[model samples]
Target chain A: MTPPETETETASGEGGETRTLYGSPEELPEPAREALGDLLLVLADTKRVLGIHYADWILGSPTLEAGIACSAMAQDEWGHGRILYAMLDDFGMDPERLEHERGPSEYRSSELLDEPTDSWPELLALNLLLDTALSVQIEAMRESRLEPLHHKVSKILDEERYHFEHARGWTARMASTDRGREATGEPFREAWRACLRWFGSEEDELASGLAAEGIVDAAPGELRRRWVMRVAPSVAEVEPHLVQETEDGWGSAVDPDWEGWEPRTRRLRDAPGPDDEAILSRVRGDRNRSLLGE
Target chain B: MSDRLVQIERSRPRGEGTMDWSGVAAATRGDRPDLDVPQWDEPAADLAEEARRALYEVPDPEYPISLVDLGLIYDVTADDASGRVEVTMTFTATACPCIDFIRWDVRERIREIPGVSEVSVETVWDPPWTADRITDRGRRLLNRAGVSV
Candidate 1:
């Protein structure tokens, strides 16, 4: 749905100025509200799945420190997911229902996290490439006209710095070895393609409408460019198209297959997310159902 | 006991010019009026030092080093009047699963101090923690534990 050009006035704030443009979810046009809600769900689901994947390796990591790092990253991802899910309450979503009751097919998470990672290299690819892509999208909302996202976006990004560092450190360590480098190449390329597709095509009506509503600071193309620029340096060894050195500097211009893409979910094809039993068991915590107070 | 008495005395509101020592004397259940109340103007430096020493005993769950030695305790302060202690701290990583354990340990250890009536730990992320933040002693401990800083 295209966002109506007209704006609606809502309640005034401390300054007593009437906000007529994307002030709150209720104030937004129907299209803008739906788009924002979809975006938040996508982000929350991606983080939730990523956290689950990270938790799978906590005990299986090659070293004690690496395992601890996985635990840390998992906690960070879960915390971020919780925050994002809670924010959906403002968008008229029942946060609890959204988190605990969602089935595999209902999740709007990126396809990159559709399955549990089987190898450390695959994990690193998700960590370094896909995680950064999510961060890049969140970073675009740092100055979002939607005031509620300001502090949440900033805090989430702040925590994400360590995630980036952790991923970069591990990626560099793995890439240093001949076998390790070879192992990571395909996973990295696969993750790169998913991230590109996750950003959607520039012509996506939802993306354009959201941008027009000022809910997000950048368009899809700009968001993708920033993501590629940030990720290019770390994965430069994996693929040439991942990063291209220009006279101006290194940049990425890889064109992913946007055909058969689901613009709303931002996924390349129709596929259920992670296994419902696995995700729900961890997320829902049935054993704690009788316990009172969070 | 003397230190406790001193804390109570120092905690009295200033600018009253004079304190009613008779009330304190009665409260102590002592008939003697000759109790020499120690100087009540001591800086909070002693309390801060004591809190720091207490925190040094609280070790990181995963590492051999204490939280204080690990440079996790950025700052510790106490409000003498309220007997409230506040500590600003950070974890080795933002996603540290031991955050609850570490925070609980810090609070428990500091609350054991005589003058501390309340303890609050504020976890911060600004100027995000790095290996460089680890102290020399912490590095030595990690090295001894077969871990690299």
Candidate 2:
């Protein structure tokens, strides 16, 4: 008799096709888990660093209203980072150490999140494009078989709605004004390409492996396509002078500042340390059964 | 030469009175107290003008927003003979993180003036700075940078 096909591949309605093969965290396949872990690290670290960057502007914003909005946004991103890190923590790693100890090079976040917001318009576009894309990604993860991740993803999706709305409102206002349109259009056009680079390669092995294991619901390309479609119409409405396409949106390059930047942090006095080994041991032991699905 | 020395002695300051010690103090100390006090012997000169002229020589490297413009050097009084200058300035913000560094930089540079013997920098936060207080030149720079002043 012919051997049963070990891998399953299928197309989800979101985009081209979601080919599910095998990278589920429950099964504890070494290579698959490693790739998924790296993907999670990138996502988690990006939010963490972006949170810090936004927090720096809390009192420095040009106006009081904007300052409060930015502060709220910073807290939201930090909260998301915490949740994602907790997932990584359950997977045999210390989230606190991973956050403060890693250099920029070790982070997997896209070049988009690294650039300091040089102007208000650039900041608005980035918050719109990047966070909106993240919202969709989190939505997809709602169905993940990794119960903890699925729960965390669902919670994050609810929190990101406000971020998405804020971006849309800011972009709408900027696009409506003559000077705003004149000033922001070119930068928006330029920044979108950097956003595109954030998504991994079309045939990224790590993404595909995660899909195979039913850990991640879709590939980055599918996510990219959905993001483009969702954002292009609104952006076109705002900047009628500009054309919208995958190339215009996704082929742009990253800013040099963000191009090679990474988080540079050290352990804070109150941060978790090696002394928590006993507590970690207990948690790890209790969760090991569900974690490894042994 | 002896005659000239006698004339110089005649021009010296005359003491008002020597410090008096009471009989009780002499009995407690077992000796009388003797005091010597120095006095300004020469006529006071117009040192203020000389100090003002000296201040002109101190380069205000930051232009359009000089020490005067930013109000950093509130008072530039000096004792030219002693060459001591006291400056009163306020920080941009009360919680300014750069306060220590700004004070050090100003003190170091101001001390380089030829006649300056001592420099004191005092930081005050009262009469806080506002955007309207920015000089015309500072306003122009902000406008050029696309910021509304």
Candidate 3:
């Protein structure tokens, strides 16, 4: 179904006449608002889960510097997640409830991040593949007509540069070693499939509707293609299905299993998310509950 | 640094009332005047230099050295036409708790400059910060404070 065109009002600024679709959540059409809310939840939950994954590796990483990097990445992901979660308030959801009280089944994170990574190489695969996929989606919203998103996109992307660098550096280093490549190859393939599936099919109504309304800049297929193009250089051997050399440029050949796809959470199955008890204990800071009000 | 240093131009017209800034496209190093090493003799240069110098007055909350010495201030430019001083800075860490206060301090301190009609402070994370960015002076200061670099 074709989404209704966003109602834009013209305003004069230093850059010239700018068109704004919605200044606040109340001004959005119900469908557009709902679509944006779901997208935001997906981003928030994914970041939250990625943060936990990174935190788990803080002590387990092979080197002290690597451990510190894990700690920093964990902090960055949590910060990004908190910022996105706070934006849900504009969409009429209680930020605290969505963050602290949500059960594992209610999480809207990607399936790749739903389970603890088994090895450092697997963590690197998640970092290089899944994290970059999420960033690509956020990048598509850089020029969103929605004001709130437009404001926050730059900061989120700015911080994410380090994440991309850390992942790329490690992936290249690991790819040079036989043992490293062997350990990471399967995880990379798994992450690649999950990321492709996370983008959903071209027929995703919410994604199409959001793209039509200028709330998001690209459709799921376009986003998946961009992500593959970005990641193919480092991981093409491990996941050859990502791209093919076309006359124009590199093109993606994604055949996601759309059957049983959960649209709201953007996963392939109704699996429970990361351990709820551990997530709550870390996210809620239960020990600091006494100091919360102070 | 390569020949492709991103020159971010932020301007706020006088009497706009709002403190909002609009950034121009990143220009090549050759296209823009070099603010990396302020002349300190020119009027605009003096203001920009004074702004950079004043940053030393704003210390990192945790460290004793100035934010300038700490390598927190990345770029500082003065727009003569708009009387706006724009500063691009970054935190030592992504999860810095002092970010808001440091930004506020930077804004307030730079506004103290005479003829400065507006001040804009932007925080960026590109080329993410590390201990190597710290200056020798900052290192000494940190060592003096019983903190190793």
Give the Cα error of residue A205 in candidate 2, in Å.
Answer: 2.0
Give all candidate RMSDs, comma-separated.
12.7, 27.9, 10.5
- 1 versus 2: better DockQ goes to: 1
List, residue by residue over A82-109, the lDDT tens digit for candidate 2. 5567567546777755655444445555
Candidate 1 clashing pairs? none
Which 10 consecutive positions of candidate 2 chain A have the poorest summed lDDT?
A262-271
Interface Cα RMSD per model, in Å? 13.4, 31.7, 8.8
Residues B65-149, model 2: lDDT tens digits: 3333344444445677787865555444332333444444455555666677777655432233445555565455445545556
- The TM-score of the first chain in every model comes to 0.88, 0.71, 0.89
Candidate 1: Cα lDDT at A3: 39
Q: Any runs in candidate 2 off by more than 4 Å, and if so which?
A: A1-26, A60-63, A238-294, B1-149
Off by over 4 Å in 3: A1-18, A241-243, A252-254, A287-294, B1-58, B62-94, B99-149
How many Å off is the CA of A27 in candidate 2? 2.6
Task: Report the C-alpha lDDT of model 1 over A90-134, residue by residue, as the tens digit.
Answer: 777877678776677788888877777899999999889888989
Q: Which stretches of candidate 1 lie over 4 Å from their true place?
A: A1-23, A286-294, B1-149
Q: How high is each candidate's TM-score?
A: 0.64, 0.49, 0.68
